[model samples]
Target: MAGGFTTMKTLLYRLFVLAILLSPVYTSDHSAMCAEAATPQTAAQKQKAAAQAKKKKEADKKRAQKKKEQVKKQKAQQKAAAEKQEARAKQQEKAAKAQAQKQAQKQEEEEELKQAWLRQQAELNSSTPKKEVVSLINIGAKFGYAGIMDKMTNNYANISRPNELDNDYAYHSLKGGPGAGLSLTYELQYGAFRFETGFDFTYLNSTSAYEFSLMRRLEQPYGGNYFYITDDLRETRNAGYVGLPIMFGAQFSRYYFMAGAKVGYGLFGNYKQRGRYDIVVKDDALRDPYGLGIHDVPTLAKDQRKLSLQQPSVSLCAEVGIDLDEWLQAQPDKKNKKRTKPGERLPFGREHLHYKLGIFAEYGILNTNKPTGALPLSFNADDPYPQQTNSMLSIADTRVNNLFVGVKFAIQFEIPGKVARPIPAPASAAEISVFDKESMTSLTTAIVQVKNTGNNRTIMKPKTLSKGVIRQRAAVGEYVAMAKAKNYYPESVAFTVDSPGIVVPVKIYMQRRPVFQVKVTDKETGAALAAQVQITKRNDKETAYSMQTDSVNGLSEVMLQDSLQYALHIEQIGYEAVDTLISDIGDKMHISLTPIKKGEIFVMKNLFFATNKTRILSSSEEALEALFGYLERNPEIRIKIMGHTDNVGKDEANQRLSEGRANAVREDLIKRGIDETRIEAEGYGETLPVDTNDTEEGRQNNRRVEIEIL
Candidate 1:
């Protein structure tokens, strides 16, 4: 790690040195521009930088937060940057604790927004052969002439054969009807014996280049320094090829002659070595060959069989031509034994180049085999369906008869083309290595839309996005025209969606609702009992959705439907008050408190007090205790407490007795924790209603203080 740090420092130093070496003016200028842009709110860039640095020190342990894109929407009524860097610096930290919570219960409006960024990329590869662009330039195009001769059109390259060529030797011999296939010549220094392909008007679709063999067309030389002769004439029986022909010219001084021959496989294309022939054919020509029907016809197979129109078969053809006036002659009969003029004649073999045009006769032998009997021309018992397939005609114009009888009209051209070379295979060590791709750890997210819920539409920039932001966009515009759009959502509705099971604090607009309210009344004789009431709040966002209830007229005036169903009850003496779920509600609501009228009230006998003393015995603890809750229930009722006394003392003593007794009773009620305002003590002085006190029991009853409900 230390080495890495040192290397990083060195790299930084090198970069700084390189930066200095470049135009410092421009670099400094760009730095100043960035500084100014970053300090838009400051008078000077330095001041802003200092402020930022100071703030950074204060925010030492602050963590960064990731920002999320938020979009919100609503029904019927809907509503829905430069600080960008600052926000990014604090995004992750902010989102971690980010929340839209409302503190007050007065409003029931909710809005949320979240935003996130996403990125994606793709690539593809393969392990197959690469595409190739072929051209002959790699080597060179095979040079050759490909065309058919209708009849050699008065050209020196014309041929004339009477026996086999129908009379019109011009067309019948050259173009050769279905006989002329193609004339393709190739000289390849390398490569294989490819198939000879050409464009034939008779069959033009065979356009592929096939491999050809390196079969040399040279013949053996007999004497010391011998010239090349046709292979068959040199090798005799050793060479069996008798169908395909390869023609080339040999020149000596002013005389030149064209010479070539045909070669082909044995019958049924049987192997010359060790393969068995699958099928066989009759040897009507004394050429016993293994193969199928009419296949063993080499003794009569035509050289121009590929042409199909005119057959140039079974013979050696030689023609002579001179630059101006040359001559062609036959070989000595002692050595070869063949001629066009017959009987050791001197043919047009060689001469001087003095004539403007030279014409010479040509000869072709069909190499036919006769049966030593009259050659059958038709089917018979000895030779049923006899078919004479070979024809040997001597001395005639044939395949390579170049008897120049007129001026030659031709042009020489250089053909630029391509040749194919076998591509070398790659080595095993050159193979490519592949590895598994890494998975994405950062989350991918995007905002579908943002909606504005305010009276006026507001812009939603990337940086100013809130976690509770809501917005919806529309494309309702004509071409090149403004669109019809407005802010969405009304403020009066109160609907919200929160994360399941958890409610975030939020502010929302809502209509007011009736909570709980009640009026007290006496049950026994239908009288009003003004009772005290108390109300309070409970939830996550706020303490309550409505007002709190407390000691009052047993009725609460507030705006909230939740509080209506809250616990509500009233208490009173001699009454089993009802506790109800405050459910029924309309435009307004009212509830009546009924007092208990069924159960009887407990009565306690009173006790006499001594003169002038206001203290009561402990026995008074039991006296009027049942009525303690009664006074507590009716807190608004004010009543007077009266006292009576027996006639056993002076008038002043009696008055004191009344006052003392009344005071004693008042003290008793006050001691019972009743509101002093509901109790008024009065000394009646033996004037108030009293039970008969003449007897001792009546006197005891008459000694009781009278408590009344005002």
Candidate 2:
């Protein structure tokens, strides 16, 4: 039995070892099993063994629950770590993207800044200066014809002569010559006008051919001089002159006109003559019973000689031509662009490029007939030379008048600088309302006409209104609006649009207009003239109605407002434009227009100057504009502007001020496109007063400007 027990113990030990090796749970509970194995017991031990087995089973369950809890906690910790790593990676990626975007934006902004700087620099380089003084140098060459105008008649160099015997006769004919000149002109431009003070080295060669003859009866026959004898001489003479011209020129577009006086010095002259003479001799009274018998000895003497002429010559010069500056060509699209400066390089191999080509005519106002000395003729005195005895054969019949006509070419070079640009018309909008002023009601049936006064562009033609309001886009400029209705007299208003995109409203009052007829007649003659008649509101200078008189009758009829003050403006091409305030609209208004002739004076009442200053005022704009228009219409007419001042200041100061004021007006006219040569400015100061300067009213009259037609 002991042996059997030993075997079971061995087997149990082996089983315990196998369980420990095969089951990790059993190995972990080995301490509890060892404690149980060390205990010794009987039936209580058996019951304890059963209780222990139950406890062991409960411990295994508790351990398994703890292990499952630990495993779940570990898995949760691992998942949290993985999530945190993924979040870190995503954050790094987001930061990198933001940095790249920031760099890109910064680069773009820098590029824009660089471009803006470049543009700013370009603007600084390209912009022109304002109101710069321009210096111009002009050189030209010219050639033309010559003519002699003789004031003397009936003696020598006359075109008409009597056919009777013993009559003194002379004839003169002009032959043209070549002229060349080099001019250095220093010009100061005031607007479109230029005041030029220059020296011209002009060489002129003028040729005049003349014939003279005289016959007479001698008192006694002596030394073969029996009958009277004279020589019929044909002579050709050349006169050369060097002149200096002082001129004023005006430029309008490409065309320019200049008028001035040239003071010339006669440098040298020469003459050649050939003649036929009838020599009458007594011949000792051959075959005659008395001594009264004389022989007719006629001789044809053809002689040629050189003579000299002299004097200081004065001439009037005038030129009309076009400037061939490529920049001066009409380009409406590039009107606002920067103009080609004087020093700017031009294309087409052109240098010194301001070229002018035109026709010029000069006439000597002074008689160019001063003989330096006499030439002794080489003739046979023994044969009785009657032509040499008379003083008429020695430079007496020669008359010379300098005249020239030819093409002139000029090149102008200018200094580089800034200049004031032309002021353009202001941009504006028109808000037109057609309404009855007295009734304060909108006239839906009224027609409105809107026209731009600057360019004479028809902004809106006469259109019947529907709602009495119309919005039209227009440039900044002066405009005329006319409203017409059936019963209400047509009303017109001059409105100025001063701002861009802003609407300017014009109001015209309607009233019962009275029909008036105007009969235009010449002041000197009772004849009619073709004229344009404009009836305008006196205050605003707005044309209420415009009509043209019949060319034959010179009559225009229009409806006019009786209550409103009115002014009449009459314009004709050959007559001075008249602007007069109408005192009475009735009585078959007989308006007289004066013909614009040389020496006619027209007072410019509205030309304004600042106190002791030469600057033009804005208030005088309308008047100056009217003057400019008048000048434009009469392109051939020349005017002299004379300025006067009240005798309040010193004579010298007043003179300077008056002159400056006159020049200021001239400059303004030139700016408006009047040519410089067409106008001349002078100052009389207090020297020539129109009225007494003792009273303020008289002084106001004395302080005035006048324009004389020349």
Please report the candidate that would top TM-score against the real structure. Answer: 2
Screening candidate 2 with a backbone cut-off below 3 angstroms (N, C-alpha, C), the clashing residue pairs are 131-420, 249-676, 249-677, 250-675, 250-676, 250-677, 426-476, 427-476, 428-476
Model 2: how far is 260 from its true place, Å? 0.9
Which lDDT tens digits does candidate 2 get at residues 255-306? 8888888888876655544455443444444544223332232333334333
Top candidate on lDDT is 2
> What digit string (tens of lDDT, one per residue) describes model 1 on residues 243-286?
44443454354555545543322221110111111112233343
- Model 1 / residue 164 / CA error / Å: 99
lDDT computed for candidate 1: 0.34
Candidate 1 wrong stretches, greater than 4 Å: 1-604, 607-613
lDDT, candidates in the order shown: 0.34, 0.66
Per-model TM-score on C-alpha atoms: 0.18, 0.33
